[model samples]
Target: MSRDWTSTLVRARSAQDGGDLALAARLLADAGGDPTAPDDALRLLSGVLRAQGRHAEALPLLETLTRRRPTSAVAEHNLAAALGDCGRAGDSEQAAERALTKGGAAPETWLVLGRARTSQGKLAQAEDAFRQALAQRPDFLPAYRDLAQLLWMQDGDLTRMTQAVAPLAALAGVREDAALLYATILRDTAGDGAALQSLAAWVERGSVEAALAAAAAASGLDPRLALQHAQRAQAQAPHDQRARLAVLTALIAAGRAELATAGLEDHLRRDPGDQHARALLLTAWRLVDDPRALTTEDYARLVRTYRLAEDDAADRGAWLARTAAALRRLHPFRSHPFQQSIQHGAQSMIDPRAAGDPDIDRLFEALRAPIDAYIADVRPGGLAPTAGGWSMSGAWSVKLKAGGLHTDHVHPRAWVSSAAYIETPPTVEAGGHEGWLRFGAARIGAAFALPAQHWVRPEPGTLVLFPSYLWHGTEPFSGSGERLTVAFDLQPA
Candidate 1:
């Protein structure tokens, strides 16, 4: 039996080396006679599943392996990686620390630790972990990627960003992910011209990955070029979903929203139940000036039913004031890059449930009725049909000072989105609509030519709910007082 298991493990390794992961997993799972076979099978099979992005499937096996071999640094590292991939960032970080304590020195383990820290909004710690990984293995590609992404997320000075990425960017073909990150930083900070020059040079070799990266970089800077590169990516990998999404995104960004309708319609025809595509289609309708996208009746429905009721509270004004104060106290006010609208300001990480403020918690509870009403009334027909209950996948508070504004963008992951004005800036210019929410404009630098279709004046104690795909941003305001608001996303259960 021992001989058979040893041979089976050897065969499994051979299969994995030959890129037959399915065969490797099957062989490992079936080799169960010997006592050590289970451990070997669990270890190998977890790796196989994780490589395939089946992290949920890999998690239980890794957990069991970790329990069986608590002292094995490799097992603990693998478990931490699985946990990170499955979105258990806090747990994954703890497990990764245990892996390090158990003497794990693999660059991949450090990369996992870095990613787990990133998810938990620990940017400095994440950067250190990634740097540590790179220090151990200079040629490690994953470490380069993790480090570059972490650095890009920080609103650090231009010199700091350039210094960190200069060494890695100097070696382009060696690490494609790092090169892409470098291009993104340049595109966002310097100008479209500089980023396009670098991206264009990189994609001249006609690689699909390079083309995809170029498409992303050119997305807002040069929509035509973005479309061309996205089309190239689609041509190279016709069935790739990312390529398809890029094409759709480029079409909208290029000010050719009318042309995007057909592509979205065709995609929906093939995959009727794709919620993301459906949401994009809804936004496309609005972009092309279609009335069916968001009619007067829809706006009326939102106005009538969506905003949270003030009558539910004992004292509406006092409740809102206290809620705002409590939320402000809960967080240490960090500069999280996740909020695209905030600049020279602070934004809270997404997690209203764990915010530890009774007033804020009460406000979220008060928002349920309007959320339920929007699903029943305003949501488009082809979108995800909700059956009453919904989850707040993300929630955050934003404090924007003078000249601070959220850039125009859409929430791709949300089904329904909202902003509740917890505190408002005094004297919103009625003519200019400063500090008000405007919809239907693309991000800056897109040159998308279309003007905003709708604007909602901010009022304290009122919540405005809109489709997640709608491009929205705040009009820049000049004032001494801050504009504090709580935003949340609602996804169907």
Candidate 2:
């Protein structure tokens, strides 16, 4: 089938420019043209795939592009980035080195190299690469952020991260983010006092971000002061989620959940897809015994568990043992990452496509039936969204040490969420429901706390699925060994 390669490329570019990426990808993929000569089409197709979070699908196209333009530094850099995105850190590192060799030490190349090094658990090497990037481009904001995050993850050394990024924070374009980061870091690491002191000047001068930070730091310490700060932030950014959420949290903490219910309901009425707001509203209504909370939550009907490998000839215990061993090798960090509920455990990189894990692929395939059933169950249940289908948002494995447990939290940005247990501690069965998954407990204290309505015993080769808005966490258990699991989220497409 003879085809015009140039004309196809032009049409593909038009679709891509007009935001019809699926059309662009289809045109490029189906075009019966010379794949090697039309390297531009390959590049464009790869970009389209990656933009849709199909990193694995893009890799071959990028590899072909690099092969076609052997000496092109940009091609090598793109391949390096794609490799990293696909969770092939070692190959990404090699490609980044090739990019640096050909491009003469471009800062972006150095930044990618640093990320690859970090992924490989080479913290010292990663730091050196990040320093090299900063040395080359003094005003690169990403370099500062990555280096600071690396420092924080490596050691909880707040001073080191602050000192490292201070100069770059002074740059005109970087100050706003740096200020916000500084506030959050202070509140997380030090306490409310440090955050309040640091944000005082900015808050007084009408910085909505600073006021929100002030609200967060003071929430539990001084409820009235926190509410005031949140109100100030809300006044500035009337429609911002951060401000709205801050004000709501403060209002609830001050024993004014009834007052916050109207606002939360209004937000949900306007955007029912806001799982975070929905979760908060549930908490507020439950606190005041609004009756709607229990009906809306519907834990009995909505939350379900499945025992995996039931149909397979292999024993479930053996399957779980095999899967657990394979998953442990993917986890690289010794400590949990920031902004996650994982307290003292190591978690695998998000959405890892560990090229050859057949057990993983099989397990995921088995999950499709249950997920499809749930989608069908929800569609006719009065909230039939305009969005038709659901797709996986992210996937990660968690290996919780003896004392580790995820604090109660909701997947605010997702529609559905899940966890599949590969390993469980003996403590789970010995006594109590330790190491068990509990649902419906709001992550708060005193009168504001909503006790868990349901609990699921952790079993090897089993999974639990529920709405992402449900407040959930695991009970911490101590003894020996680790509790290993894979978790993922889903969103409407």
Candidate 3:
């Protein structure tokens, strides 16, 4: 352990350069325990630990490095980032501020500060930090992406989202997700043809991310063009599942689902819990009236509603009021967030399960019985639902204002999906059908464009559960105070 630290660090760096993180970690661990170990060894070891998601193991080393190099901006910045990763957002903010105070004006340092602020729910400060970072380094694509994401979530203004990152659409090395976001915003504002054309310049330059973006934009515009870009992207990055998904989407769009059917089915066979693949395969089969697809669309068998049971001793009214208040505080945004169906509303990004509210915590406790009953009792299709196990995958609360509605869509990645009402506006309480949930329609233009076959009215403290493939939406209400609800998706555990 007390061997020459310098030589060990050199070998570790070489290992790290050769992409042998395990070897580098081993070499550094041998010396990292010694107080006489060089700063280089501890730093490299911390990096390896972080890369491997061993954040707890890395934190102590990072703390030690920060203490030893108190005046070093890079040391402070690294600790800030590591602290953010370890969920100490307040500590991260302090460390990042210290780094900046130490004359570290690097764009990376600003980005770290932005991320720390974001972790603490300081969206405005995070947005400012990202803007400052971008101003310092205009070619910093990460800044563009972070800023765009923050603005989009804040206002849901597609125009602002475009203005935030469109300047960098011509730059190299933008995040793949950022490219897709830009394309999606364009598609929303200017239509699929314009969206596809927007990325053509970059796609023509052999950028895989751009090609993938163009593929998404061209999904409904030109099937052949979408397939071409997606195939090109897949060829460049054979292991990227996103590219493969693009190819599959294009195949379905091109009416050549036959070519993609075997692989999708084989993948589902190997991993039967892959509901996303199942959804795609179902879509493909529905194109040709495959019996397998028809069975899954049995709305009556798959969709059901549950009324939360309340005992005489339970203070149901007060509990719902508290839960609604908790949810209301979370919806600070001006409009709905990205890639969601909620329109003319604001949705909560915080996961209610971990929001640390007593009433919200009890909401899950209330749902457990109904969810269990639904899973065990409901017979989906002609048989039963298939899954290895079941658990909630993600959850969010939506607060829809007047004229708010949800467009028809399916949850491809979920085996089960749900919406639980916390509060309903006066319109719904009046026995009116406005703002009612409608099911059994694929709004996506296709051969099987079915009108909504069933409708469910929302009531306070009631939950509706349905198969993920069931297309559902909400009708816009005329005069409404607000409609508040929480929804979650379930997948095989």
Candidate 4:
């Protein structure tokens, strides 16, 4: 390269490193037409633009760069990412596939392809791609994390997911991501105790100590330890939001609601737009029944998003009747092992605290009535019932046998949602009968408390309601029989 070009490149690189993305783009543009001039420069500029969330601008530049250098895997990958960010999953997958083809299926290429496929909801295909990436390059940390997530989504054993990522945990630049993934795996598999232990260790020893500590506390793990780590992290990096959130979360989780409320108010005073802090604050106030401090708008939004309805009865009942009748006709419900799996998935065989005595069908019917009534009460004219109070709609049922469990997750689109228990085993394992409902902290602007709040020890006859966006899940059953439940969602209508 010419001295002038080299000099211009250095200045552009400097500007990018300095975070002056616009300046870097302008400088790169001025470097002007060597045959390579600007394509190389534009590629770098594209990356900077992407980092700045200007994905539209980045896509064309990266696409042109990849077209010019058809074998450039990095260019292709960046283009695919830009496209995916813009919601063009099909285009992203095509670009990712081309990159993988040209690059001979390297792990990075496969990683991109897997991500693209995942965005398109080709989960099985995505899992295969991720597994293939790992098979080709076992040390590829990204693939491990990606595959673990896919497995988790499939509701595979949490321990297996953790084991999958364990090998990559020590890899450079992967420690934090791996730790977070591992923490999630532990949370789902071993319950809060294990998750709390892992989170505490990460807070004490990891590079993302503050974030880990905050996340741990938010998840209802060792608040004192998390708070200690948060204090240390803040002492070292006073301006870090991660540290502040961690401290705030620890306070919340520890049930120090008053302090958490005060601390959040002070923090928000300094940073008015802190949405996370605000959300925590709302949750804290709600917990304490301090209605005056709550954000009416946020609560309204949450209710409007996750409430369920009674009119849903006809549709849900019809589907249930059809499914049950079909199962009865198919005789799968009579088969020992397949029936076992269904019963296990439905959690019908276990009895948790406050376990209500209701037949699965009866409970479902009862639950539907209230939901339908609520929908009629709130739904605007001309809309339909969706899964989670969104415009979309869906419903499903399951039968869980002994030892069955559901992992944590949120209903993405539905406004109102619920699960109605139908069957409970006559007996349960010691400590197994505590099947309880849990909800995560609302994502809002202020800090309320730490340990993203959870409600435990739910009764079987009792129906609990909350926002759709709130992350929630079920506890494992230790009973010897089957547990049955029908879970449903309602869209915006």
Candidate 5:
């Protein structure tokens, strides 16, 4: 009996190390058929499930184990992680605190607490938690990467971001994320040349993670090399979604949309529930100029709702004027950061309180009806292309002053993208078709001409929705007044 139990444990460990998660889970779950054993097979199974992003499924198991061993810090830590994944941030924070007090000191415990704090918008607390993780394990690459990412995302400060990750770059067993962050920051702040050089140097190391990062970075700087690296990553990790998506995205960027279309179709055949792939396919079809991609029916569903106000011109003008003033006061950027390099003028960062204003909140509420209608009309069969059903993913407002314009771009992570005009300058309405939203433009660096197939004039209170993959931007206009609009991206719920 002792030998049998040992055999099961060894086999389970071997399977997990070999990346056979299903086999490892089965072996662990069946170990002695008793979760109360010292080995704790149930906890192991829950960990495996959580790693696979099955947090909801793993929660009950974690909860059961935590109840059985209430003082076990390991159980509490895992529970906190699962709760965080489920968006129960408050509960996760409490559990994390309990784990820290009960469990022996562990860097991962601190990391989880940091993540919980970050989710709650407690930036300073999160930073301190991550620092505690680093203090516990100096060479903890994940903690360094997280710290760097948080710093960068907060203020877009390259110096502070670099300082956060500099120690880990030269550390042994360094992960790909650190290198990727460094390279991305260089590309954004310095130039593509510097970024590509950094990526190439890492690729020379020949690690799979390095190849994956290089593939992503090369997509913009060198598409041919990106495709090669992506193919290598795919071959190295056949089951990895990162490699597969890189291949698909590289194909599209390289102007091989036909290949991208075929690749996505094959991928969907294998994993039909891959929302990201489904979303990419929409872009692929559009890139290939497939008529079925965004049809007249799709356009009909685009502007489904307009904000209701008194029909009187004075009332509408007053509202637009007030909103524009509010937006100007909230503009967050002087020049667009590299992440949003397409903007020729000031563009705001993702505001944590964007929809908090009563007016803004009401606008979002008003827009929901059309969003639901659009989703219903598009997914008539009730089959969502992605994993989640349908929901708004992110939203931010942009205020473009005179000479301000948006360069053509696609929202890769969004299933649907939208723009709701709040204010438009007189120059936009008076003529040269300036400051109008145009769609169907080819993605940058594509080896083909794809001009704007359609455009819509901005009107206060009117909202426009389109597939996220479609390339769109606003024409530059010469005007002293600012053009204010709120934009958002949506994913499956």
Candidate 6:
């Protein structure tokens, strides 16, 4: 490389290292536009854009690079990731397929394909892709993590996930990722206690301690300890956003709203539209009764993005029938007002701890075992109460509507809570009806900060379990038919 090009690369690297993504982007752009700049410079620039969450801006550059170097698997993979981030799933899948064709089944390529399929709601296909990636490279940590997560979502089996990645925990190079993933899986599966122990062990590794600390902070644990660990990480890489976000969120959860406010303001001053900062700010405001309200357009936009529905009458009828059947099986008591309210679209059931049908008890036991195991393994000593003996106590319903939407809310007394989709309406609008489930918000309390608010689009076999107190609500259905979901809750035994 020429001296000027070398200098440009060095400057860009420094800016990126310092977490000055804007500066890095500007410098990279200047160098990239230079006809004499090396290909490496362009590649590095694309990576910086992606890390900074500017996938849209990075797409054309990555695309052009891939075109110029048709055999460049890295560029193609990057392009695929950018495309997926931009919500162009078909294009992303095609790009991944092309990369795999050229690279001959590389783990990275498979990982990209798996993620793309996941975003497209092709979970089965995505699982296969992830498995394919792992088959190619058994030690591929990312694929393992992703696959484990997918499995956890589907079956709520934390032990299986831990066993799947156990080989990684002892490998020095991959140990940190393994520890983090293991801790996360444990935290989510078993409870918070196991997660905390795993996290502590991960921190002891000395590499990426800051990242782990940040994760700890984000999980709403002791920020001071997390910050101390994060400081170690920042020493090596000053601008790690994951670390920063973790610390910032920890501070907010720790009730240091002033520090969080100042930190967020400073962050926004540098990048006014930082979504992470914006999310933190929203969370901080939740602590105080700040009446800064969201407009109708804001709610509408959120609803449209997350809701699911169908257009055909046949689809609607099918959905209702499936949902009704699930409800009847779950709740057979006719005299009960909650169960009697079963209609075409909505119905509720009551399963009390003290007294409930044997069938209902068995059904809840089946659901609780896997979930409890997962919570025990993942969350460990976290606040998740062991409700294995607890019967399904609270009553909830399946609400279906052609375009019905539910505003965000959290369950109050229920311990383990869930929503199982009996039927999904066909795709409609620009996409299919989203009417999916979304959970996580700081306003729900410190316990929810770690999950970082995730959206799961419901499918026929989709069943999501979370802490009842976690603030969650459904997006509206927009297709021509009703969406069907069965909601239930568990109480202390």
Best by TM-score: 2
Among these predicted structures, which one has the highest lDDT?
A: 2
- Writing each residue's lDDT as its tens digit, candidate 4 over 1-493 gives 4536667778889998898988888777643344556576777877777776667777767767876888887778778778766656678789888877777567777787787776555778988888888888877766876676566555546566666666654542346655665555455445546655555555656455525534553445455655666667777678887677777866766667677787777877886545456556665677677965435353343332222223466764555444343222211221122111121242211111112223333444455556655565545323344534442144344555556555455554455566654344554334443455445544221233233344444333344544454545655665465544455655553
Residue 294 local lDDT, model 6? 31
Q: For candidate 3, what is the TM-score?
A: 0.72
Which pairs of residues collide in candidate 3?
none
Number of residue pairs clashing in candidate 2, backbone atoms closer than 3 angstroms, sequence gap of 3 or more or interchain: 0
What lDDT does candidate 5 reach at residue 152? 58
Quote the positional error of residue 267 for candidate 4 in Å: 2.5
lDDT of 1 by residue, 161-246 (tens): 66776676776645566566656656655555666677666687766787887886676567888899999999999998778877
Looking at candidate 1, what is the lDDT of residue 193? 64
Local distance difference test, each candidate: 0.72, 0.79, 0.76, 0.56, 0.70, 0.59
Give me the runs in candidate 6 sitting further than 4 Å from their true place: 1-11, 30-38, 158-163, 166-176, 197-493
Q: Each model's TM-score?
A: 0.74, 0.83, 0.72, 0.55, 0.64, 0.47
Off by over 4 Å in 2: 1-49, 52-68, 155-174, 186-196, 295-297, 311-314, 377-389, 444-448
Candidate 3 global lDDT:
0.76
Candidate 3 worst ten-residue window by lDDT: 441-450
**Lowest-sum lDDT 10-residue window in model 6:** 333-342
- Residue-level lDDT tens digits of model 3 in 1-493: 4588778888889998999999999888855568888787888899998996677689889889989988988999988888776656678889999999999999988998897776557898999999899888987867876777678767666777777776676553344554555666656545678767767667877778888878766665667878899999999899877788778767876778777777678767876665556667866777666787645346667788898748553578788888999888766676655467776777775667756789898898898887777787774322344654467767888888778989777776677889999998878766767878887555542222455667889988899998786778997887847788999987555
Please give the ranking of all candidate structures by lDDT, highest first, separated by commas.
2, 3, 1, 5, 6, 4
3 versus 6: better TM-score goes to:
3
